[model samples]
Target: MRFGGFKRLRRFSTSRRLWVALVLLALLAAVLLLQQRSEPPDEDSGNGYAGLGEDAMEYAQAEPSHSLQFPGDHGPHPDYRIEWWYLTANLEDENGEPLGIQWTLFRQALASPDDEDDDSDSPWSTDQLWMAHAALSTPQDHWFDERFARGRPGPDQQGQAGVTTEPFSAWLDDWQLMSRDRDSGDLDSLSVTARGIDDDNTFGYRLDLTAEGPLVLHGVDGFSQKTADGQGSFYYSQPFYRVEGQVEIDGEMRNVSGRAWLDREWSSQIMGPAQQGWDWFSLHLADGYKLMAFRLRGGGEDGGDYLSGSWISPDGNVTNLDDDAIELIPTEHSEIEDREIPTQWRLRLPGQDLDVTVKARHPDRWLDTVFPYWEGDVTVEGSHSGIGFLEMTGY
Candidate 1:
């Protein structure tokens, strides 16, 4: 009789596992179907909102002067329209060859948490959407891929793609970035891993990042103003990570060590109606200084360009920069896929007496994702010499 009871228990466990697997498969299919029905904004239309500027009166707005708390704010803000965990690295292989990497996880709310009905308890019900992007760039080759998933609400049901704050983990499928010390919840030290295939070329990385400096807040107390009308985001960064790891490209692996920057921002309206897109830069100067700057195509005073940045000293002190304090100019352009992209730029910050040319290492670093853009490693020259990353959108 005891043997029979054990056999019954074993069968029950197997059946439960099978049922859970089937449920997950169904959830994934539903997410993909819904994602396909949704359309991205037309890039050529000069859409200022990136399809995110729509009225979100029901969702939470990123108000100024609200304090940002750690470990808690590190996780998802489902009440907002959009949020992202963005990380970029500039590394050199064992042979001293340069490589670039970008990993991002973005979360968008399908509906307000308050709108969740009785079906919210169902395993298939989800009001959150998660998307992730992974890319690896070589001197001549760039590989990129993206993934999407649905997020389950509640602490016990994390679904396929979600972020947890207690131990600091953010994942989609197998790609993950989490705290190195599972017992700690801080973002100072992390381990990241991701792999993807593009056009017969396989690429990925497994890196360990250790923060060397304190976190830096941008704009006014971590409230970054995006437009002249007080619209913006809660932005901050850990710009002093020392990274060492292995990166694989085209099935070839190499050991690498370098610097990385991680950015955290969330907002309901990151751009105004007239603002098209932006050109953003994160530079690591050779002299132990760092600069974060951006130029918005429109929505400034009198519908002009809006500019903002933060000049960081080696110790992580931040000096917020205004539009008049910095200058950004496109010096050269590259015609890629029939689009004229500014592959080279001249950046000037008068307050720090810094004048530098920031140019993309290679122009083919375009990410042809659902919302295509150019993002890759850049070399800084002129007054300051160093390496960093640049992201340009809206052509």
Candidate 2:
């Protein structure tokens, strides 16, 4: 569930949800542009609005000045056409074996908000389509699954899937990420549960998460610009959760405890066609500092590249970084699932005197999801050593 450059945790919902939304929007663009309202715009020749292209005027766009309100904003923003809630964690078993977990819920508005109000005549009427993906990873193996459904916004709405911030819950089928403390406005404490089966095995997790720090806003108070062209998303993260619970794989339960990261982002146009894909990183350093960074390929002048990141101090101060402030270079690649992927990376933050090599825990952490991508636990070595997660997409 990585949106190419978004590199999940905060990116899974963005990437996975946007994948479906863009595919659907692309189909719409194909039909509308081929019809050529006024002889097809040069930017949109019906190739689908991969990044909304020149036909983005039809849907609501994510502008920088938009305020992200409290719990309400934690739920669905159906007006935007696409949104997601993504959760990722780095857990350790009783024996101290590293584990990785992910759960994501994506909402793709089948029709614009204005249309949903008039188009749905019944609770079953489909205005918003939802998709979810869940996965669990051991040091040597990975398992995952995906599900889909249709929904409409209303108090009467009920299904295997939905999101409500009142009590703060996001779910699809039996997989859920919800709040444990209802009276609180912030997501201070929460519980996550999910069970999935992929052809040969059954996997799931039941975990308790408690926030140890405040929410970290990414890119100028949640407006994370993706490309140099300024297309981006409303992104924020609670990357300081302490987790404890049980993870079940193949029906075997293992008690686990570790740290987790929760990312919330929503946007209409998160990328442009020129921006091919991305390599994203979320590192939880041993000293309490956190880093979220990415490399968006091909959005520069003449289709070059763009880079950016956020540095969070132990006390929760965020230092927004531009392309020049940080460097993320792929140091090695591996052939996995028949795709060439960067299995290792060299991250350098000179100002902080931080230089490290982050490598995947294993190469086979390939999620055979609707939009398949690589997601796994990573080990950081060099200036500051720790563990984190890596999400690479579009390759």
Q: lDDT per prediction?
A: 0.82, 0.78
> Model 2 lDDT vs. the true structure?
0.78
lDDT of candidate 2 over 198-311, digit per residue (tens): 766889999999999998889977889877888788999999999999999898999999999988888766666565567788899999999999887767656667888899
lDDT of 1 at 11: 20
In model 2, state the lDDT of residue 101.
95
Candidate 2 has which clashing residue pairs, if any?
1-12, 3-15, 8-12, 26-48, 160-173
- Cα RMSD for candidate 1? 9.7
Candidate 1 local Cα displacement, residue 182, angstroms:
0.9
